[model samples]
Structures are given as C-alpha cells and as structure tokens.
Target: MKKTLFCAATAAMAIVSSPAMAQEAGDIQLKVVGTFVSPDGGIEEVVVDGVGLPAGTDTAANDNFVPTIAVEYFVSKNFSIETIAGTTQHDVDAVSGLPAGTEVVSNALLLPATFTAKAHFDLGGVKPYVGAGGAYFIWLRDSAGGGIVPLGATDADLSNELGFVLQAGVDIPVNDSGFGVTLDAKRYFIDTTLQVRAGDTLVLETDHKLDPWVLSAGVSYRF
Candidate 1:
C-alpha cells in the first residue's frame, strides 16, 4: 500500500510540475487524495465481568486505505485553515493473550473529523507546511468477531473520543493555473474505550490506545 501511494505521488508530481501561480490570501483549495490509515491499537486495561480474560491480553488494529477530501481556505499568504472528510474501517485482533492472532472486533468503522491551522513555507517553487490540529474519532459501527462471538459476546462499541493531531506535508505546483500535487502525513494522539456485551450482560470492557498515522497523496486545485 505504501509503494502504491508513493508511485501515485510520483506520477502526480511528474504530471503537474510546470508553471504555477503563487498562493495568496483569500484562496480556496480543494484536494482529493488516497489515504492510508494505520492505527497502533492496543489494550491499556481490561475490565472483565462474567467472562474470563487472560492477564496479558493485547490488541492490534488492521490498516485501511480509503479516499479522502479536504478543503482549505488561506487565511493569509503563509497560513491556512484546513479540514477533511473521510471514513476508515479497521478490525482488531488480540495479539498476545488470545492466540498468536485472534480476531476480537470486526468491521469497526470510524469518521475522523479534523481541523488544522498550518504554516506554509516556500522553498524555491515547492511549498512545505507544518500543521497542528484537533481530531474527533467517531465510531460509526462495530461487531464482535468470530473469536469473541463464540464466547457469548454479541455486540461491541468503541467510544467517540476527541484528540489532537500533528501534520507535515508538501505541495508542488503543476502549472501556472491553480493546479498542484500534494503529499501529507498526520499523526493522531488518541485513544478509545471498547465495550462488549451479551444479551443484558456486559462481558468485556477495555481501554485501547488509538494513535494512528494517516498518510495521503493526490491532486489539489486552488482558486
């Protein structure tokens, strides 16, 4: 997935770099990108009731690739406000206590709503930016995996949590027009709580660390 995104970014850069206008205040840029979401998920603590859980239980979240869109408004020639829209899905597996790898949560979908304020720097023709932002990870859906369902676990839910993010990226102009290619990466400092239930009984409740690295590459049009 990383190789594919790198190749796409290379292609975009090669196709777009010609002559381009400079950014200015009151500019609006729209970007469409292919994003890679990689979450470093793990169990922080387990609250067990009416079930048996191993002492050293831990977890890992599967990576996902999805399409993303962003809108940025230049507040100044060197500063902008940006936000993105996208959804990513992941599956969690118990990495230590259950087995070598045992599925615990299947099809957990999330909407990561974010906003960032960035400082852009001009290096000859290429523009590089550093941003600081806030994020809210909203869990849209989730279900118990096969490994947990057999243990009478019926449903699972991840808590909606608010966190912060750090970002860095570069934008390369494609032409004298408002066309460009962009490559971006953001690191999210966040966490979530997972609760599993069976009928009317709360079977398992665990806290998880959800710091995810979100990488993106694609084209941008500014006007």
Candidate 2:
C-alpha cells in the first residue's frame, strides 16, 4: 500500500510541475489582445510656399483603443517569429495657434500589420521576450473638415508608410493548461507624406511623422 501511495504522489507532482517547463521548440502561440495606442515624438513643422509654419502648426491625432490578434511560431526554445494585425481610428485636431475648443480638424483610419523576430527568456513559470521587426501602415481614409475644404484645401491625402517596430512583453502561464496572459508594448517609427490639395492643385506638401506607442494585455493560448 505504501508503494502505491508513493507512485500516486509522484504522478500528481509531475502533473503539477509540467507547466513550469519552458516552451519547447516548434510550439505555436496565438494571442487575442486589447491594445491602446498613443502617438509620441515631436511634431514636425508644416511648410507653405518655402516658409516654415509655427511650431504647433501641425495636426495632432488622439489616442485610441483597439483589438489586436497575433500569432507566433517558435523556431527554437528561445527564438520565435510573430505577426500582428490591427486597425485604429483617430480624430485629428489643429494645434498651435488654433482657437480653444475648435478641435476635430479631420479623421484618420490606420491599419497596421507587423512582423517580428523575438527572443524569449525562460524564468520559472514566466517568460519575457523582446522583438524587433517591420510594419506596414495603410492610411485607409483621410478626410478634412468641411470648413477647411474651401480654404484652398479641398482634401487631405496621406501616403502609406513602411516603418520599423520594437517590442517587449511578458507571458505568465496559468496552471498546467496551455492558457496564459500576456502584456506587451511596441513602438513604431513611421514617416509619410501629406498632401493638401485644392481641386487637384497641390497647395502644400510636407513630411509627416507619427511615432506611436502601442500597449496591450490579453489572454494567450499555445498549441
């Protein structure tokens, strides 16, 4: 009877300790995360007719929240490749000398797809990772305010951007199941061209930079 009890206890211990093992090579992880995006970095000056405008003459995009999905395929115990997809919308406001409470200069929709190569560190039941990759930004829709369209600016045209991405995150396994939680942050360096047009006549063209930081937290499942 004592030998049987010892065997049962050993089996229980193995079941409980299984999750502590690090993720092995050839594992696949999928995550559904909620993300909050905030635009950072200095705003560039808008130029008109060879004259630089005021420091705050550019438009500012508001912070936004969105849902994102990611898939990671591990090539080794410590190396993986991940891809993420998400879309966000932002309300643009004219800053600088613009009158107070006169916000809502325009609206912009952004669709970003990112691909990264990550290196994971195993520490007990927790896994921490850092990644670097590239991103492609599609400016789906950019519309100007009605009041500004007649001021020699009928429309706002934004070009698509290709940028670099930096990422860091941590994952905590829950129980011995393949379920976990993840917290992640990513920074994107994006630069694109903005064209102000009046009936096909280009009134102003300037380089616009939007370096945004995305923070996310959600559940993860490994297969």
Candidate 3:
C-alpha cells in the first residue's frame, strides 16, 4: 500500500511539472498593435529668450494614432523583456502663449526607442502584466508652424531626450495554441526643448513637457 501511494505522488508531480502546464522558459511573443499617442505639450519653463515669457504661457500637442509592433522574450514563465517599433507625429499648438490655437510646430516626427522588463500574473486564461523601462525620444524631423513663421521663425529644432515609462496590460488567450489578444497602456515621463532660430539668431527657446499616454490594443502570437 505504501509503494502504491509513492507511485501516485510521483505521477502527480510529473503532471504538474510538465511543459504542457504553462508557458515554457524560452517563449517568444509577437504583438502587432495600433497605438494612440497623446502628449501634454505644456511649456515647463522658457529656457532661453531675449525677454521674459508671457505669464501663463502654455502649449498642447495634438493626439496621433500609429501602428506599432512589439516583440517579447520570456526569461521565465512569469518574467519577460520587451521592445517596440513605431513612430508618431504631432503638431504642437500654443494654448495660452501667443495667439490661442496657433500652431507652434508644424509636424514633429518622433521615434521612441524603448525596452522594458515585465512581470506577469496568470489568472485563469487571462495574463496581466506590469512593466518598467527606459526610453529615448528621438526627434526625426520638424518644421516651424504657421504661427511661428509669421513671428520671424525660420527654422525649428527640438532636442532629443531620455525618459522612463510605467506599463500595465493584460493578455487573453483565444485558445491553447499561443494566440491571444492584448491591451496595454504606458505612461512616459519625458520632456523636450524647442529652439526657434531666424537667420542664426535664437529668437525663441522653450522647454516643453511631453508626458504622453500611450494606449494600444492588438493581437499576440507566441511561439
């Protein structure tokens, strides 16, 4: 009778530890998503100018929708590292400074290079994750907006900056074959400096707050 009990316990342990029970250690997940980027273009403080900035000076960046792709590598069943590929474009407008609703930046294209480490929790078939990571915002191209051009602005340049992000998301598997749907959100703490020049003379310089909320929903395939 004791021998029978030992055999049963061994079999139970094997079943619990089998690869079929959960995601393996080296799983890779690819997610194709559509992302929404919204940024708060509030001027933190004017960095450089001949005269002082107007009181209550502020700005707002328009929202953008772009396509993004993410690749994730599982370090273990519960831990993973992820990187993303995408770019977004925005038009910054003056809200309180200058004329209200005036465009300060025509089209500023941005590339956010990101890498994150995530921890996941499996609740039934739903996997929820939280991640933290580093990001560098690269300004690909930009031009003077309508309002700035009339104000003697001949060229516009935004500085590249580094920042970090906090992330949260959920993955719901459609079936057991590594196909799923994912919903994710990330909040970035970052800022950039805008420099306006007219004939080599710095006409306006301002520090802008670009704290953007990135939201995404998409399909996931793990292998």
Candidate 4:
C-alpha cells in the first residue's frame, strides 16, 4: 500500500511536469501557504463489562495544529485544479483509568488534490476568490508510544480517502513579474478511520475516525 501511494504521487508529479501538461498550464499560479488547522479524532476503548470485554466506545474532542502549501493551475481565471500537501501530528492523551497514562502520536503526510470551480473578483490591489471542489487524500501515517498502547499493538494505517475542499482567499500584487502575497483558507470534509490488529491478545482492538481541517497563506506568481 505504501509503495502504491508513492508511485501514484510520483506519477501525478510527472504529469504536472510534462511538456504537454506544461503547455496546458494556461493561467499558471503558484502560492506558498501557511495553514492553521484543527484535527478531531473519534476513538474506541476496550473495557471489561463485568462478564467479558465490552466493545470499543466512541469519543471525540481531539484537536491539533497543522500547516500546508498549495499550487494551482487555472483552467481559466475562474476555474482551476489545485494540489495542497501538508503534514499533521496528533497526540491522543490518556483518558479515564482504562489505558491511563498512555499517549498515541500520529504523524501523517497529506496530499489533497482537488478540482475547483472558482469566481475571482478583482478589487484593484486585492484579488479575492471563492471556490469549491472535490479532493483526494493520500499518504497518511500513525505512530504509538506516548502512554497508550494500541489494542493489537499494531501501527497506524491511513489509506487514501476522497473528500471535498472549499476555499476562499485574496491576492495582493507585489512586483512586475506578477509576484505577490496570498492569503487562503480551506476546509476538507473527510471521514477517516484508524485500525489496529489483535495479535495474540483478544483484549484490545484499535479503531477510530478522524476528520481534519486545513488552513494556509503563501506567495503567488501568476503568468
């Protein structure tokens, strides 16, 4: 699975760099963005219900900070396809006394490639835009060893997921090369889950849902 994700990512980059694709670059716009994001996790816990072990329970309110960068190619001045990539680290703290004093930290790489339909409103020095599109998420990782242990003691698995990206931003013209500063914010609506295997102990199983947010700011060069 890891190999396949890398290969797919490489192929996508290749296509973007190809001559034919380059020629289709049309309204090429490049931006470097800083994202302020929030991540929420839905976790399950294993408990002994006075007879045997009870099923996992669901919990939320897990939060974290993350950042990202985005590059977009305008199909027109108002329509575009953008690829936003970033990294996120989440720490799940200990709760109750069940698996108390345990922490699970998950570090993941995110690639959300989306197709957007936007309308740009040029307000002199500020070019603001609004858009919406579908996004694909790739390359995710989860790590343990904080204070909590996964049920089966397995690692984190984040398969590719399909979601939607909604965005709004403004561009400030800088120089003669159409170079400028840009501020953009976007939200990714994704339903993601983490799973752990039960090696020899039927005492624990790991599974949870994660839905995250993405925000950013950067420089832009329009040709």
Q: Using Cα atoms with residue i matched to residue i, what is each candidate's TM-score against the true structure?
A: 0.93, 0.83, 0.88, 0.67
Q: List the residue pairs that clash in candidate 2.
A: none
**What are the per-residue Cα lDDT tens digits for candidate 1 across 1-223?**
6686667666766665466687889999999998989998899888664668876879999999899999999999999999999999999998997885788899999999999999999874578899999999999898888888989999888999999999998888878888888889999999999899998789899999999999999889999
Of candidate 4, the 10-residue stretch with the lowest lDDT total is 16-25
Provide backbone clash counts, one per model.
Answer: 4, 0, 0, 10
Worst 10 residues of 2 by lDDT: 96-105
Off by over 4 Å in 2: 1-22, 47-56, 100-105
Cα lDDT, model 1, residue 218: 86
Order of models, best TM-score first: 1, 3, 2, 4
Using TM-score as the measure, the top candidate is 1
Residues 1-223, candidate 4: write the lDDT tens digits: 2354345334433333212212133677777655566655556433222213224434343544455566677776556766666665555544444354355444555555666666677554556788888877665556544333534444545457788778876666655456666666667777554443335333334344445565555566777
Give the alpha carbon lDDT tens digit for every residue of 58-106 in model 2. Answer: 5567889899999999999899999988888876565654443233236
| lDDT (C-alpha, whole model) for all candidates | 0.89, 0.74, 0.85, 0.55
Q: What TM-score number comes out for model 2?
A: 0.83
Local distance difference test, candidate 1: 0.89
